[model samples]
Target: MKRKAPSNPVTQTQKQLSLEDDKVKALFNQKIWDPKFQDELKDEIANAKPYNWGTIHDLVDDDLLRAVRKEIETEIHFTKKETDIYKVNQSGDLANLSGLDWNDLSRLPNMYKLRQILYSEKYRDFFGYVTGAGKLSASKTDMSVNTYTKGCHLLTHDDVIGSRRISFILYLPDPDRKWKSHYGGGLRLFPSIKENIPYTDPCAKLVPQFNQIAFFKVQPGFSFHDVEEVRVDKHRLSIQGWYHIPQKGEDGYIPGEEEAWIDQNISTLAQLESRTLQDFEFPNAEREILPFHQTKHYERLLTGEEDNNKDCKFLSEALKLTEREIQYLSQYISPEHLTAEGITKLQKSFEDNSSLQIESFLNDPKSDLLKKLIKHDELNKECPMEAKDVKAPWKTATPSHKWRYLYMDGKSHEYFATEEDMLENLNNEEPSNFKWLKETLINAKTSNNDNELEIALVDLAQFLKSLIFKKYIATLTLLCPLAEKVIIRRFRPGKDFTLATKCNLSEVLKGVEGFVDAVLEATLCLTPSNGWTSGEVGGYELYMADETIDEEEKDDTQYERDVEDATVYRRDDAGDSVLINKPASWNSLNLVLRDESVMEFVKYISWGAESSRWDVRIQWDVKSMESDV
Candidate 1:
């Protein structure tokens, strides 16, 4: 039997472009290069929230699909996995299941027609012309077709498979009774964190209707979503593909481009709470990373809330939603506070901190729990920086990675995950300015030397970690921001501890002349938020009397000598101040003097300095906090 034809779903209002049309080039120029129009579209995109949710019924006509399948059937390979199962008709220049080199559909007529139609001058004019922007890639032509059968499903996963800016699914179901939402084959959409990152939940969904088209931008994590299970006994036919940059007539195309594109949109490693390095790197590489829900709709359901009502609008008079609720809607609400009081507290919190208003009807004593939560937050810091984070997400090291460390041989070092990425960049082709960085940094330092060293770090990642911890503390410090509230609690090596306690703010920072002196004595720089430290990754170090780390250490000296040798230095040769250096040491710490190297290839070194050390007063003890208020 022959496949049914895809009805002409193209509307008169919708502009159509033919591959053979000359208007193609004109459309490309006017849409992407038009300065004024481009600017406007950019602004719109910037303000647009994360988005995705689409389906197309007439993507391929019957004659087209049948003819195309016949031509490429020998070329298709179906790889099915538990979570998702699909038959691949065509991939880019990558290898197929045959373990052999394959020709791109450059010679196929129907395939060529597909490409021309997608990138046609008229199509560019109508779509690109409106979007006012397009990705210029070395190899952008990528298309794939798949078939979903009984019990076969593709779970939630942001279609962030490649350098995909947009995702479209052209369905070819039997032209009969509606491709009802119950038939099980429907498209889902998700809201993104900020248009780039996929979230853990889906905010939208859609079942395919014959001759219909659905499309959306590719939001990574925030746009997490998945297809619904096929509930009926029927096969769903769809041509799912992406709009890639023009490969034009060129040779070299990197296969990892898709993965790299996705990586580029992800947050810093620190934000992700990922690895410190690699498998052999710090923090155990064996430690599990964040769960990959891929698509958010299902995972969010697991959290109890089945849906965001997809398209259901809030009834303003029935139960008005405050502005804060709207804002929080964009954020991932921590599941711990899911009670009625929690909801009220969250609503009230918006009222207090934001211009959000809560309807009188929703207020109840049940909100007391959230109020207590806020109070608790006001009383103490909630999130502390665990030493384990040195190997946690964003900072966790991968395997044998050390490209970043070899790029620099500077002094006191603090390593973060971003720095490690430099090592994985060795495959860079064409002209690159960072190529020499890896080699240059490796030569810059001889760990055994006593020269002024520079620490090559992923400053952003370090800064984010510091920010998270600080913000949490600030949330708790609703009590007050004190500059130097020195709690002189003694830690008898393995016995005592210093904890955050109620202390007077004015008393700590008020005209205290010795505070600065003492802090400078203990560390080098501070972050300077209400006198609290902020970005002090490569923390302050007090070199030795030799103005170098090599200064002789009298670790077992009598109390008198210990005090004398533990002095902080402010001159040419400084010694270790607070912490001690490990033996493997910053000596072999690697770095990239330039930004051209693959960061993951280097081993990061930490600045561990030690003097004739003697424990002193505990000062910097901070953490993150959250409150319903």
Candidate 2:
């Protein structure tokens, strides 16, 4: 009998592995694989409002998953990686199992078994049927484990990467304890504003539990989601992985679909760069308002190339300002900033650098009243934390994957209105200055009004937009007769931040060489807390250089991986940053002329902060005369 075929060693090994796999399948809720259960699941997934997704409980054998968790805790090393979009401790790619050495593999037997069973043909077919994603690759496996502690979060994004057909997460957060929704760490899915722009708010959320698995088809331009920040000082551990399209030699392999899928999924970076989309989505894009003749004079003032008295005369003439207008402005403006000598010195310094910080931007009387009111509100008022709770005269910034804060748009009386609505709302019959100054005086006298906060903010905005102040701006930065926007922003402790992003030049301003590509941004900080020292409690502003990538490196995925993620950078990284970092302080002002190549962000405020970071922000579109020269 051919020596009994040596008892068929291969058959024995296969039989042993098959028994282990069966044990793993028994761990899952049996109904998951049942025909009737799957039919209901498929219907639920297809009709799930907001997006198509599904979740299953008791997805793994408790004893096996417990062993896998123990293996990870003891055998793996985790690195803390933080970016603008997320902060988590992550293990090396668990997908590279075949590359591990014998010693490493020996320490991860349970994990190895878990991975094998997850990708086993039987389970793959079930997942495919439910998701309608077709066959998954046998040769390709991509996954990693992450632990999010307090304050850790992943911002919104559709996990559409090279050849990825489906995405899943298996949660293992403290198997003995229940994970509460208020503890955060829930998977939040977003709705779309359009084809590619996800809305700022999440429409659906899934709170995870031990032995739970959540998954969705990796649909490009749609499936946007984020992991809510883990609060309450606990660890949220989960294994995240992707199933790619069938690779070469696998069943249902397609020759070019992987590459095609990757090419079709546009990145957030590319979408942000799209002019038409940005114009529609951006709440404020710097508008061009200064006439050619006025812009030329403004440029000359900044360069110090024109006679000082002549430039002053030009400003006086161009703004068409009367002495009466200057007198009215002096009522709220600091006397020190109104003089010729003060203006000239500011001009020289600003031309030399492109930034300035004015300590007492508001006159003493006005500053005192504003600070007192702001402090009272901070201590006594119930600040709105959610976007939905924000009241009129205040709107929460949208698509918060990029930024989050409450701001008053000056014209918030028309809160539900559009930019076009602004033009119609304006009293074209009356002079802009006349309306502005009148509002300022009324707010100044009504310091004790019930609406003191709103009035103070609007008053301060009017001061920044006043003719005398505009003249000072023109004299110093040569960016006058400019289009201006004033926003009163409040960043609550532990709740607000703005991610690192570059200034996008408005469509009409793009490609116009010699025109200043910089936006003149100003902030008047009014934090009520102390010890914001060294960014420990965060609430600091940082400006850094845009990372430069070589042309050849763009296509090299390895090189891209080596670079810090585009959405974030290390604080100590070497790059040409026009240093203007400032901590949140009471009654201080910071001004910087930021160019398109510079990236900026307000660091997330820590929960330990004594109070919120409050400020009035002003941005302007400054025209350049370099082309004329």
Candidate 3:
């Protein structure tokens, strides 16, 4: 009988691992399947605020979960990955375990068993019932193990992507001790102001413990959430996974259902392209065209109409700072940067690299005064921790999906809470004003008060918006400014960031003569702390090339995988895509001529950071030198 084919151990193990209803039930806490318990959970989920979500304590059997954690610790290797949105030590997708041979699976036998049980029909049915996310596909086993060490975090984003029916996280932090709220790494849920617009802050937070599982249905335009930065030096381990809509042969599978769901919830990139969503974004990329009178000075200077000189002479004369201009600028700008030679060198560097960083950009008196004021404010005064608490002249950048920070836009607009507030402001004309700057300067000459820091920053913003300063920028970048927007921003530790975004040129400037399809951007870093050089504290400014996927090479599953593994699509690993990475520094001015193809962001500030990242961010709609001349 052909030697009775020595009983195949591998096949036997596979058969043993096939999760049956009884076996699956035994792997989880017994109460999970209780009819009364399920009913309670369903009701709790339905009543949950900030969109329906549920959590179960003692989700898995203690011994089994411990065994699974042990196997993961020994058998799995994690890579520390950082992108624009998150930083975490992550393992390869656990879904790939199905493809592993029996020998490979043997090394992580408990993990394999856990995956099988989690996606098993019995458990999925229970999960679907509790969350009211009907019919999850067992075939699509999506999971990854992530360990958020010190400073690791994920910024706000809705878990809306292809076929993702429900999102869940199984915490496996030290099973022996309680996971306290102070430890950070809390799952923060944000309430929506309107569809697709999350509040500036999270209203609900879940501090996970070992053997606890938190889950929610993946609702588009809602369900915005983030993983708070792990503040302490602890490994907060969790298994994050998603349940997909029923597949082709599954019980609840309906023809075209998944496709229609995907269509309804567009990809992030597609949402960004939608005009409707752009209206809700704060500090909108919109640039206000400088009044013709203000711009005519630079235009005449560049074209040599002021002096009627030849090309070389006109260029030399335009680049040289006049005595009065130098005298006025010397109060705020470093003498070295104001010199003719220094200006020529800066222009040359910018021409070559399309970027420049000038250290000690501010003069000694101004730098020393501003630094003292800012550092004092940080240490002594309580920084406003909420949107409502943010006072006049300083507004919180809103909508959260695009960016969040405290900013002063050199305007006197009130704090806007709703779309209607923004609309009302749009309908009413409130041109830029320097009344605060005037008052601040007067106050500085008279007294040393609590508002000195705000006054000084506002004063600097006005100077940056001045025509003389624009002339200085013109000489440095060799680009004539057509329009300008100046903002003084504060990225508070653990609370503020800007997501990766491309320059949005104003519609009026798009095809105008002499116009360049770029924004001349500058950042004057005012962060007073010292330990941010390595970017470990997460307050670095980074610029990269926007990546485009070829249509022919695009995968239908790309959006799903991008959401799962953000690092894979970052393009920074190659080193070529990243154009600039500037850590927060005191008194350094960074200038970058950014086209539509370049993406930029200030990384999320970590809670462990020494202080807030402070900067003056300026952008000018610029025109080419050749076109101007």
Candidate 3 off by > 4 Å: 1-16, 93-98, 299-319, 415-429, 436-449, 562-574, 627-629
- Between prediction 1 and prediction 3, the one with superior TM-score is 3
Q: Compared with the true structure, what per-residue lDDT tens digits does model 2 show for residues 296-354?
A: 64555444466544455554564443567557767776777667677677767787878
The runs of at least 3 residues in candidate 1 whose Cα sits more than 4 Å from the true structure, single-residue gaps closed, are 1-19, 22-79, 83-109, 130-139, 192-201, 209-212, 245-263, 267-629
* Backbone clash numbers for all candidates listed: 98, 0, 0
Which tens-of-lDDT digit does each residue in 130-205 have in candidate 1?
3433543322433455555554344334544435566556565565557776676666554532432333234556
lDDT of each: 0.31, 0.68, 0.79
Ranking by lDDT: 3, 2, 1
Query: Global lDDT for candidate 2?
Result: 0.68
Residue-level lDDT tens digits of model 3 in 1-629: 11221111246767766977888899889998899999999999999989999899998889989998998888878888787778888876442343456776868778888888998889888998988987888676667788999988887888777788888999999999998999899999988877887888788999999999998888887888899888887889998888999988789999999999987886555555567777766676577787655455565643335533345556556656799999988879998888878888987899899899999999999999999999899999888978878766577887787788998776655636543476446545355566665574455554434677777887888888888888788777778788887788999998898878788888887665567888999999999999998888878999999886665665656434544542223434227888899999999999999988998989888887899999999999887664334
Off by over 4 Å in 2: 1-29, 92-99, 291-353, 357-364, 412-449, 474-481, 493-495, 506-514, 534-538, 548-551, 554-581, 606-608, 623-629
Evaluated with lDDT, which candidate comes out highest?
Answer: 3
RMSD in angstroms, all models?
Answer: 29.3, 7.7, 5.1
State the lDDT at 524 in candidate 1. Answer: 10
Position 341, candidate 3: lDDT: 86
Q: How much is 381 displaced in model 1, in angstroms?
A: 41
